[model samples]
Target: MKTSIYATLAAVAFALPAMAQDMGDAANGEKEFRKCKACHMIQSPDGTDVVKGGKVGPNLYGIVGRKAGSQEGFKYSDALVKLGEAGEVWTTEDLAGYITDPNKYVEEKVGDPSLKTKMTFKMAKNQADVVAFLAQHSPDAGAASAGDAAEKPATN
Candidate 1:
C-alpha cells in the first residue's frame, strides 16, 4: 500500500508541470503583449479590434490552436509553411517557444538550418504571460489550453 501511494505521488509530481502550462496570468500577459504589438495585431473576424497593432505580422485573434503559417492573407516564409505541412499547430507552449526564438524553433521543427523566419524579434522573457494573453483572444481557447497541457514537455 505504501509503495502504491509513493508511485501515485511520483506520477502526480511529474504531471504537475504539464498541468501548469495553461496557468499563466492573462492579466500579466496583456501587459507583456505590448512588446508583440509592433508586429502583430489581435483582430477578430468580424473586424473587432481587441488590440490595435501593426500589419507586419498576421492577425493573432485566433492564433492559439491554429496551424502554423495557415493564416490567410499573410505570406509566410517557406520554412513556416513547411512546418505547418508537417502538422505543426500553435499551442500556448509552442507559441512561447516560437516567441523566444523563431529561427531556432523553425530549424528544429523543419530540420533545415537554412530555413529562417521573417520575424527578427525574439521574446526571451514573459513568454507564458504573452501566450496567455493571446489565448484569451483565441476562439478555440479552451481547446488550445487543454490540448497543449497534454502535448508539451515539462518546463522549469
Candidate 2:
C-alpha cells in the first residue's frame, strides 16, 4: 500500500507544473508586456491608443481567443488568416512559441513556412513574462473593464 501511495504522489507531483503553466499571472504579464510596446500599442482608459508610437504592427488589443488576422482594416498575411481559420486560438503557450520563432509556428499551423513577420522586432528574453503581461492587460486577455468594452469593439 505504501508503494502504491508513493507512485500516486509522484504522478501528482509530475502533473503540477503542467497545471501551473496554464494559470499565468496577468498582472505580471502586464509588466513584461513593456517589451512589446515598441511595436504594438494597447488601448488606453479613455478608449484611445496607449502607446501611440506607430502603426507598424496592428493594434494588439484583443489577440487572445480572437480570430487571428481579424483586426479590422489591418493587412494580414494569408498565412495568418489561415491560422485563424484553423481555429487556432492564441493561448499562453501559443504566444510563447510564436514569439520564440514566428516562422516555425506559422508554418506548422499554416504550411507556408515563412521566416518573417510584419513586425521586424524579435523577442529573445523574458518572453513568458511578456505573454503574461499582454494576456492580462491587453483586450485579448479577457480582462476588459466596463469602460474598456464600452469603447472598443468586441474582439474575442
Candidate 3:
C-alpha cells in the first residue's frame, strides 16, 4: 500500500509542471512581445497604451475570450470573419496555436485551405509566452483569473 501511494504521489508531482506549462509564463511573454510591436499594439478601452506599437494589425487588448476577426474598425480577411461567424472564441490554447501559425490555425479551425490571413509572421518559439502576455492585458478574461481557477474543482 505504501509503494502504491508513493507511485501516485510521484505521478501527481510530475503532472504539476505539465499543467503549469499549459498556463504559460506571462512575464516571459511580455519580453517576447517586443518582436510583435512591429505590427500589433495592446491599447486599453480608455485609449491608454499598454504597448505602443504599429497599427498594421488590430489592437489586442482583450484578445482572450474575444471572438475571432471581430476587432472594430479593422478589416480582417474573409477567413477570419468566417471564423468569427463559425463561433471561434479565443481561448489560451487556441491563441497559442494561432500565433504559431495564423494561416494554418485559421485553416484548421475554419476548414478552408484556400483561406489566408493578413498576419504572415509566424512565431517559431515562445508562442505560449506571447499568448500569456495578451491574456494578462485581457480584462474580460474571466477564465484566466486565478480566483476563478481556485473556485473550479481540480480534475485529473
Candidate 4:
C-alpha cells in the first residue's frame, strides 16, 4: 500500500506541469500573431475585424473553448469533425499544442495515424503566445468563471 501511494503521488507531481501550462503573455501573443495573418483572421460576430488577414483558414474569433471543427461553413477535414463529435473542446493548453503541430495533434486526438489538416504552417516557438492571444478573443472561454468573463472589468 505504501509503495503504491508513493507511486501515485510521484505520477501526479510529474503530470502537473503538463496539466497546467504557464499563462503566456497576451501582449507578446499579439505581436506573434503576425505570422498567423497569412492564413487566418480574427473577426468578431458583429463584423468587427480584430486582425484583418486572409481567409484560407476559419475566422479565429472565439476559437478558445469552442468545439473542434465547430466553425460554421469552414469545411474542416473529416478527422477534425470526428474529433469534435468525440467531445473535444478547445482549451488554451490544447490550442497551444495544436498550433505547434496541427496534423500531429489531430492524429493524436482522433487516434488515427493517417489523418492530416489543411493547415500547413506551424507556430513552433510562440505557440503559447498565439494561444493566449486567441484566448483573449474567445467570447466563450468554457472553463472561465463568471468573474473572469470579458465583460467584467479588471480589478487590478
Model 1 per-residue lDDT at 109:
87
Highest TM-score: which candidate?
3
Query: Candidate 4: misplaced stretches above 4 Å?
Result: 1-21, 142-156
What is the alpha-carbon lDDT of model 3 when measured against the actual structure?
A: 0.82
Ordered by TM-score, highest first, the candidates read 3, 1, 4, 2
CA shift of 89, model 2, Å: 1.2
Instruction: Give the per-residue lDDT of model 1 (tens digit) for 66-92.
Output: 899999999999988999998888987
The estimated TM-scores of all candidates read: 0.79, 0.64, 0.81, 0.78
Question: lDDT for every model?
Answer: 0.82, 0.63, 0.82, 0.79
Task: Give the poorly placed runs of model 1, Cα more than 4 Å off.
Answer: 1-22, 147-156
Residue pairs in collision within model 1: none
lDDT of 2 by residue, 1-156 (tens): 999999999999998766444444555556666767776787654767644545566676656556677777778776777777877777656777888777678888877765345655566766666665555545545532223432332211
Q: Which candidate do you rate higher for TM-score, 3 or 4?
A: 3
**lDDT score, residue 152, model 1?**
31
Per-residue lDDT of 106 in model 2: 81
lDDT of 3 at 30: 86
